[model samples]
Target: MASSLLIMQARLASSRLAQKALLPIYAGKPSLLYAMQGVYGVADAHVLACDVASFSSFEPIAQEAGFAIMAGDADDVLARFAHVAKEYKVDYVIRATADNLIVGQELVRLALDGAIDSDADYFCFEATAHGSGVEVIRRTVLLDAYANASSPFEREHVTPYIYGHPQRYKVIKPVVESRFFAPDLRSTLDTPEDYTRLVEFFTHRAFPSQTIIEEYIAWMRSNLYQMSL
Candidate 1:
């Protein structure tokens, strides 16, 4: 069985929503904490990858959330991922973003297990606007891409080199069957509008759980109906 690691890439320098990771989505917990908790048991190891300059700001937050921390190049995300994969000796890696608070653990497990069982170079859930999702990559493939990829976009986005070269890498995108397939719903926290919707959904409810995406969508639909009255 191949060992897998989950790396949540985060920084305080987002252009649209500065420090969005540190903002609270429920109660007083930071959004990073919620994101981390969402994938708590889905991987063998979970680490927060950030730039050295921002390590100080992310350390305490990561510590509080019980996540391992790694610091690397701010711009070269692919290099940072490869470095972490090598350092941890993990054969596979799951890439996650900190702003995605509603990432489903079930979907993450399905993607990772599918990648490992099928020996795929890359695997991802079909991108849906209903909620965030994760991607799985083989460590050796990622390292190769990092060593040879020249474009800044490929380096920054990570895994693009592998998936972009379909002839070279086997990629799998699993379809998730769920009634919560509303691709029109935006569940990721990217802008002030997104944050506002998140706050409204989580305000009086218990800290949003794994079913947050479904719950939020149901609530939005209900609210719309009430307004039509």
Candidate 2:
């Protein structure tokens, strides 16, 4: 069995919602804590990847969650991921972002299993809620993209290069289950509006353990209904 590492990338510099990941969502917990907890135990190892400047901000939460911290390039996320994968010596990498508070663990497991079973360079769900998904990529595939990818967009968004060149990399996208398919739903914390809505959801509407996709969809539906009123 190949060893896999889950790397959740976080940073404190965002213009739309500055330091949104570190903002408290529930009682007193930062949103990163929730995101970290969401995908806690699915991989062989876990890492919190951030830029050198944001390491201090992220270290405490990462330590609390027992995730190894790696500081790397700020803009070139492909290089950051490659560095972490090489450092950990993992065969496969499960990619995540800190803004996605409800990136479902079950969905992550499914994607990881699909990547391992199909031996594909890349694997993700064909359709999923905006923030309730992850990407699984072979370490060699990531390294290849890091080495040969030249565009800023490819370098900044890791795995885009792999999916963009389907002929060069085997990309597997399994269809999501009907119940979990909600591509229109937005759950990422990116803007002030998103932050306010998430604060409300986490404070008043979430289950004790709120990472499950089914529960998230229910909560979001109820929240949206309330918002429209």
Candidate 3:
């Protein structure tokens, strides 16, 4: 069987929070390192760089930091993703954003298996705002969308065309035990506020073992009222 996972889409660009992925988390390592290492247990992982001319100096940093990085358009993310998919030649792709460092490995393996085994073109965690975990997609399905999608929005954001066009392709979502809002627990390194929150929490804890999900769930339980609100 072909490799299940390949690139973890990441970059040092974000309008709200510049360089969010490379921000230091714990153990004096960059947050991308945390994200890279977190998924390494479940499958082979690489970092997909938003290849921008003159503005993407951090590609070397990601490389020096030990993540195999690839380059493609910064704005046309579908093309970027398709480039990596072709480069790696993976059977399936697990679309995990750099921000989603809290993502679990067992969940990734299970969801990937479902996407590959079933006739599903898209196997997602959810179809709404709470859909913040892992996303699994097969190669044939991705190539189909990558080839046919034409709208600016579709090309800009990868897989939305496929997810939105379920009539054209089968989509499956694996079941997981979840009912609470969970409030993201300040996961998925986003804005400056998010970094402040994450840094404050993670700085006190250790690395690898003291992960985003574990830290968030604990803090969420402790600050339930704040989290609930």
Global lDDT scores for all candidate models: 0.81, 0.85, 0.66
Which segments of model 3 are wrong by more than 4 Å? 53-56, 64-66, 127-132, 179-186, 210-215, 225-229
Q: What residue pairs are clashing in model 2? A: none
On lDDT, the stronger of 2 and 3 is: 2
Tell me each candidate's TM-score.
Answer: 0.91, 0.93, 0.83
Top lDDT hit: 2
Q: Which pairs clash (backbone N, Cα, C closer than 3 Å) in model 3? A: 121-170
For TM-score, candidate 1 versus 2, the one ahead is 2
Off by over 4 Å in 2: 204-211, 224-229
RMSD after Cα superposition, model 3: 3.2
Weakest lDDT window of 10 consecutive positions for candidate 1? 220-229
The RMSD of every model to the true structure, in order and in angstroms, is: 3.3, 2.5, 3.2
Encode model 2's per-residue lDDT on 19-124: one tens digit a residue. 8988998878999988898888889999999999999989999998879999999999988998998888888999999999867678888888899999999999
Which model scores highest in TM-score? 2
